[model samples]
Target: MSMLNAMRQKSAKAERSCVAPGEAGCDPVSDEANGPRRDTESTGSGLLQAVLTRENLRQAWKRVKANKGAAGVDGLDIDQTARHLVTAWPTIRDQLLLGTYRPKPVRRVTIPKPDGGERELGIPTVTDRLIQQALLQVLQPILDPTFSEHSYGFRPGRRAHDAILAAQGYIQSGRRIVVDVDLEKFFDRVNHDILIDRLRKRIDDAGIIRLIRAYLNSGILRDGVVLERYQGTPQGGPLSPLLANVLLDEVDKVLEQHGHCFARYADDCNVYVRSRKAGERVMALLRKCYGKLRLKVNEAKSAVASVTGRKFLGYSFWFAKEGVKRRVANKPMATFKQRVRQLTRRSGGRSMAEVIERLKPYLLGWKAYFGLAQTPGVWRTLDEWLRHRLRAIQLKHWKRGSTIYRELANLGATEHVAKRVAGNSHCWWRNSNGDIKRVLTIAYFDKLGVPRLS
Candidate 1:
């Protein structure tokens, strides 16, 4: 009988901790303020009134998050994983790191096409030597433990880095109008046939080709939620970044050959020409380039705006309304928050708070997306929220623990009132404290962004 009672208590406590309407009220997963289970001392209003509905929860979440920047998560895993892969190829890495090996061997030639048109070009022979060097050069830096997943690919902010070079007179601007080009799903959508064609041009060894094919094709999804699964081969594989780097390097050569001066750091590409007429020529060349590669640009999310502090790969590329601006690696939190607000606002009033509230679904889907280590940024935000709460409670005994918490979102139905209770634990908590003599009054009282407890 005692064991049965204990079991019931445990089950009830589990039920109470969720945010959905039907279950026992749980705190926000992003808030991490939910303490160990304690028996509820029910106020006259009961726990139901305390919980917020999903709609209200969404609203409040956006209001807070839009005002604050979203954080990077599981970025470390990509770093460490990349390091391990690179270090696995030591000789190539050493050669590339020391700059002792030349990966791209320049071969100048004129080739005849099926249309009987011949063109002079400098084609790079993609040798094993080049491949190894490329991998090593890209991988060695990321191997450092400090590198986070957010740092994996070359970021868009590299343009600002080049702009600095122009400002410093290292490179003359030369009346160039620069247009940035971004490809949609560069890796995931890579056609195996195209890759094979490219690979065949370099190596004739059938064994090596087979080995590479199997290695590249083995992009089997890791065990996880279906939507989050990625192919294990070159698409989502550890070596894909390096491969993509080499591919883009080839693309860069093609762009420059057609009279478009190019600057590319990873997938973020910019084409610069000597005049506005040249800029039109550059854009035309870009279309040709993408068409040849069987790739397309996502023009909707991408733009040719007079760039400001546009973030790419976790760095800030600040472009002046007219001239190029300095390349700053990290923007202040305030700057980042403003950009987040702008992006959210531009999202057709997707309503920032609601998007943040919806972040729970992503937070819960973390296991599906990257793995156990790659949780949503909201979890850390929640922890910070809890620490504040604990400080107010004057509770010094609390210590942090692993974030291996279970999903509370999928627990109940959207139609059920209990499910509604489970979905919005915040309202539940607030309503529960309605009659309490001393509960902190939270209000958006100041524009300085002080989350107030009046």
Candidate 2:
């Protein structure tokens, strides 16, 4: 009887060892075709186990804290993370281990666009964000390798400048005809089935894939209602960027396989060819290819234009005497000017000193970002315009004609010039360009330590 019991126990152990991937404890192999899959460190347990490891969760928490986003529908924030996780984390982990984890609905909000419309955004719970971040760190190494070299949106060690330089190189080599492509409602229209299918082609980890699917179907909390999101990646999800890239990578490959010189930053892409005819052909190919993926191109904004006036990564290009030149595009330039105008508004009611302080940081930030432009004249011209704004601020501060004369003279403006300028009540803006320059000279701005774009 004892020998028979021992033999039965050994057989039971074998049955448990061969448990399927979906089960709690199973060692699944990496085969996306039909069987269970594995990530780098699958514990026979799969990506579910790999992602919930202590080290992975800790790293995820660190990133979640560092990013410091707003509260979701739960109203939990980074500051409350440690306290909330004291007991909640273990339960959460257990659910993940048991494959019972369900992401909370994302809080939906709308924000104004720069060009004058609103865009939808979804904010996930801080805890959900932590998990997503952790999962992303693991998947990034696996998926990023397969991405296109020409695509540079939100990837580690990649920037808009990288995309810009790639396009610059292409244009300099004489691919002047450009297909400036734009996607229509990209984030709101990502097809969940297609995204998951593309993902399976690269990663065989079924657990992580299910977690991602849960997120897509997690629903949106908006206006006190839960709306299901069957398709579309939420804009603010930590995992969304990487997921979007997975789909866009196909476009990049299509461009590459077709032998077109192109550069892409997120949804913005520019395909360059040697002639107008080639550009037209590339455009046709993109429309048809994008449709197959259930992606739509913004037909009105998508155009074939010369590299001379074409904009990519916020910089427009044209051939100068030496070679191709790039500068801040018109839209961004107008936006910058509008921002400066707002900061320097005479009716803003801030003192000249306060205005100077506010302008300092804005100017420094703008210069740091846009200073890469090869056009120094635009900067010099912006500097001149900025100083005019400063002078107008002082005039507005004086408010009264008598005070204006007194302040201008005190600031070293000649009495004759100050009197003549202050006498015209309606010429404050007019005088800012006139004799006010004599009062607030470049030397004066230099004394105040104002930032110069040039």
Candidate 3:
């Protein structure tokens, strides 16, 4: 009779752990690879009821569905899971409430870095992603209000532009010495102990804590082996960006307490000091603070320089003879030109119309991002350079001198100039800027729907 009574009480506890299926709440999972089940006090039944609901899971499903991405270790694509989520989520929810849900090992992927080498990322399953989104939805509201105003990372409604604006304000305020700092492998180096301890300080829900820990500690599935990660939030995980903000929030405090002018967008940090000596002192303080968090700064890449010397958010700031000015950073501008050159290669089999079609997406996107550039002269220069390339391609398509002459004549080029340009066999690049320039006017490209930067 006592044994029956104990079993009845256990069943009642499980029922109390979750709310009615029709209501909204959370769905959490644990890592099968973790050592033991050491958890904080379980969340009150009231919060669990609020976190774990069919409505909540469905909302998460809608969000994860919209942000379609590569499948996780399960090989289940977002599209493939939508049809089954209805039936599958209920069982998953039951497992979560029973403390038996185990998230699959994360799939390991390596993405090439722009400069060189590679960076690694771990992808979670579609189901896990949905659960993660649900977790993020609840956590963001509670913790976002507590973060530093200078932080403009993955938080809702904050963008890189805000950081840039703040940095510019600091420069204009006479904090011209910029300490360009970056964390070395920040995502992979985030200490789990530090992150979780901080989370506990803000949140007391043990179930939520366990769910996040599972996502962090889940082994990386690479080539059929489960490699355990002792620390660091895995990049590409939905919760990582927020977790990153949480881990780096202390950096903001360190700077603010010291009265240093600084702006941090994720791990890309810039501290502005009035003099070089102050910059040096600020760097020393930052290093000590990072040491406490176990995060390493990329000393090889970090520098203390003038505001004009460093690039922030793809724009370079310089003090012109008149006042401060902003322009596209040198490296990005060069890269944009390189991309245009590649796309407009005369050797490509694409025709003039096809080439314009191919270039539209890139050109339009570039113009949209850089349209706010303070220097209008750069756009005019880019416009001319691009037209020159297009004219060269059209001339190259004509191939022979006679063909070039006929095409140029058809393009409304004068007889004397057309003949002179066609006969110059030196190179199509040279001939392109000659009489052909008159024919391939800005209006001609405008008619062809070729997006012009200017």
Q: How displaced is residue 214 in candidate 2, in Å?
A: 1.0
Provide the TM-score for each candidate, comma-separated: 0.37, 0.85, 0.85
Q: Candidate 2 deviates by what RMSD?
A: 8.2
Model 1 lDDT, residue 332, Cα: 32
lDDT head-to-head 1 vs 2, winner? 2
lDDT score at residue 359, model 3, on the 0-100 scale: 97
Query: What C-alpha lDDT do the candidate models reach, one value each?
Result: 0.36, 0.79, 0.78
Ranking by TM-score: 3, 2, 1
The backbone clash count of each candidate, in order, is 37, 2, 6
170-281 per-residue lDDT for model 1 (tens digits): 1145433456566876655555556556655543332223333433433222222112212212222234555455445556666645654444554666554455566666
lDDT of 2 by residue, 22-138 (tens): 344434333332222333344335565566555676688778888888998888888775667664765665555444567889999887544234678999999889888988988
Model 3: residues >4 Å from true position, as ranges?
1-40, 44-59, 112-119, 400-426
Question: Which residue ranges in model 1 land beyond 4 Å of their true spot?
Answer: 1-176, 222-236, 274-277, 305-324, 327-454
Q: Which one wins by TM-score: 2 or 3?
A: 3
Model 3: clashing residue pairs? 24-53, 25-51, 25-52, 25-53, 26-51, 26-52
Sort by lDDT, best first: what order? 2, 3, 1
The RMSD (Cα, Å) of candidate 3 is 6.6
TM-score winner among the candidates? 3
